[model samples]
Target: MTAEREAEFDFTHPFYQTGLAIGVPREDSAGILRSLGALLSWQFLSLVAGLGLLLLAVGSLLWLVERRRNAEQFGGSPAQGIGASFWWAAVTMTTVGYGDKAPVTLAGRLIALVWMFAGLIMVASFTAAITSALTVSNLQRQINGPRDLPGLRVATVADTASAQYLTEQRIEQARYPDLPTAMRAVADGAADAVVYDQPLLQYRNRELGERRLDILRNTFAEQLYAFALPAGSELRGPLAQEVLRVTESAEWQSLMDAYLGHR
Candidate 1:
């Protein structure tokens, strides 16, 4: 779940305005860059694919060894035995052994021992890959609310509510003419993150795919959208009532679904 902090923007506060910022250490920058580079490298992808193929090959080998020798545990027709072998390989590789099946043969046990060690290496690589993917660059994982915006390169569209909010909070930001450009800044590494409307950010993130960008679940300084009217307009009350009525109807839901999907 997304964690939210208070929306109060204290412009006069030293923490919000200016101070000696405690940023990610420069010493760790090289390691973080290396990790990110590895994650996006072709070599890493090849290694992952090779490991997957190795798992399948080991599973097939196990099936060949146990199918005839131990028919009861790894029993059934050739196809079924192969399927069981795959199940066993998967469980063993993940270290989730159920112990319902085992190989009694010497050769099979030797293969299992080798596979166990290989699985350890594979698992360690997978964990490192996931960690590198998650902790990309210096933005560790503390970005939960607007208060965390200090010392980060933030982007937003110019002349929008988000831009105004950033200004009021005395937060440094890069302003773009449009949402796409602002989001692209984040993706291109020109900006560390983008702050904009939740729906627009969500739609853009979906379009860009999670690997390219992601939207933070928590939102701060929420504002209500309203229609503007001429001063002393008599139609205000009726219009407001009708707006509420229509928004509560199925038609509004259908419109939302058509535009933004169920998400």
Candidate 2:
């Protein structure tokens, strides 16, 4: 082949190639991206769904406890009824800006404002709690980290992305229902390493002080942590996109760095 023809066919060149060398068509690329998008969407929706349920539960409880006070303050308005109180609490918790049915009277408005701010704090606290809980639950599924070493029978949390990665790599994997069991397996010499999310790894690394375990330098995949739900849910895609946007925002980045460090 002429130098020009060689250059034209040089898909492996450091800078120039725009298409896959293995002849994966653009359609295939799109399909792969779509599948990944779906997975992310599932996760995001799961988080939102969990939070939404929590908000409903909390809002109901709060409204019930505060309804009598609110009714008296609202001049015996039925707006202080359980349903209305719950609605107010929901709107306040999520910070959803629906202009309908806000407190019109001075005392009612002041109470509403207080409730609004309270809702904000509660929602934030609830979200953090849920995330922490889920992270802990998710981490329990994976063994520690790094499976490539000999005699290391690493395990991942069942149904997690890490497990999926192992299956893709043809790596033999053990699945566990929870972290304590997985850790016990390691302590018993049943597994050599554990492959799990960074949060889980960090938490365990702290908990396993004085242990002789080695966390590997080699990271297998950069799986995005997300809420999971059944496929094709309506809230999935929008929630995923919102989460991605938030994650990419400067505030999100700072929060991540504060928690996970600058890396």
Candidate 3:
């Protein structure tokens, strides 16, 4: 009697028939509903808030470490204080070393020990964080690191976008006049890879021992490089946005296919 009733109930439900037609199990549908519900819950928001807090904490830790070093170095100077330490930390990490200030005495030199090591780590970590954040922010919000390249030496063409990007990324490199000179530097063991655009890099790959050198997949800025001015300069932000948009489009993919001829 119970088996006959269950069979009738199953046949009567049109929803079950529809689910079978779509090849979705009822259990799977229920799981999807649960997932959707969770996404709408406070737990998801709390997770986001927690991640934000973690980032803030990391940033603060870096800042405090820098402050402590600065205080130890220049505690005596009238101009040197916690605030001044912050500026100094930024400069030091950026490797600007403007030499506007100096540290004196035994205590200061001791403090230098901590700064020297911590500064390098802090700079690399901070660069990665800021760049990653900025890139994501610019893409999502529509607004907007490294060690020395491991090789005997490397070169970038002077005043070009490649040079600018490499310099900004803090890669150890020299500047050369022409592509051949840069290539020569690498060929002769004076350098590793000549940092340049896709076209130039491709050319080098063909002309040189292709297997010998490798292109660093790590691209600094995806957008076509542009210049910024003090003010009233036309073709700055618009040009940058235009370049970025094109580079990310399907047309650009076709262009790459034609130009590169290989993935």
Candidate 4:
């Protein structure tokens, strides 16, 4: 129970320990421009450009080694040789094995052999790096935890503890009438993310069949779920006893596991 409620009523010992969690859409194709911007990130572009430069350097080296003797495949002129070498580097690195170009001289063959092995490693590394970059860009919305709430377009249910917490913390939010509406604000791109009770967000996330929403594990603003009784109510003592008794039992753990799928 919040301090505000505690002053008016007696509450049993907390039965459940939960916290506010952040929820975000896994993907919202709502903004084509935003997706494109992420795809063309500086890190991604730099990797591509760097690979291109590597190809050029390898192609130039091959031309220097093969231009005099194996001119048939290397090319006739300096310009032609460089262009042919470029094609060779690309095909070789990709393992296409077009058979249109083959190094003849010992030096050229040695260089090609070295490139073949290096290309395998480079290709695998670049592929993994690009995939990771895209995945991070797509899934991460700069809201990893509570500290990221500042200046974010956060959504939450109005008149709830989550809302009160945001207000007291001075974090700006777009309050909705309920949890679904607040979560929908995030899915439709109206808000960057949603903040709400952990169990509520988790349940809603699973119910969203499309699996578009994900509840972050970064729980904050811990809350206690308790039974509030009228002042001086006799049931308060018995209820508190029951809560503590039940919560301490193995059956409680089993119940939680059956419903929440055991942490």
All candidates' lDDT scores?
Answer: 0.67, 0.52, 0.48, 0.85
The count of backbone overlaps in candidate 1 is 0
Alpha-carbon lDDT of model 3: 0.48
| Ranking of all predicted structures according to lDDT, beginning with the best and ending with the worst | 4, 1, 2, 3
Top candidate, metric lDDT = 4
- The better-scoring model by lDDT among 2 and 4 is 4
RMSD of 2: 24.3
User: Which candidate, 2 or 4, would have the higher TM-score against the true structure?
Assistant: 4
Q: After superposition, how far is residue 260 of candidate 3 from its true place, in Å?
A: 2.4
Measured on C-alpha atoms, candidate 2 has an lDDT of 0.52
Name model 3 segments beyond 4 Å from true: 1-145, 148-152, 166-171, 209-212, 225-254
Q: RMSD to native for every prediction?
A: 15.5, 24.3, 28.4, 8.6
Query: Candidate 2: which pairs clash?
Result: 43-227, 43-228, 140-179, 141-157, 142-157, 143-194, 144-194, 145-194
Instruction: Select the stronger candidate by lDDT from 1 and 2.
Output: 1
TM-score (all chains, Cα) for each model: 0.46, 0.32, 0.31, 0.57
Q: Which window of 10 residues has the lowest lDDT sum in candidate 1?
A: 10-19
Score residue 172 of candidate 2 by CA lDDT: 77
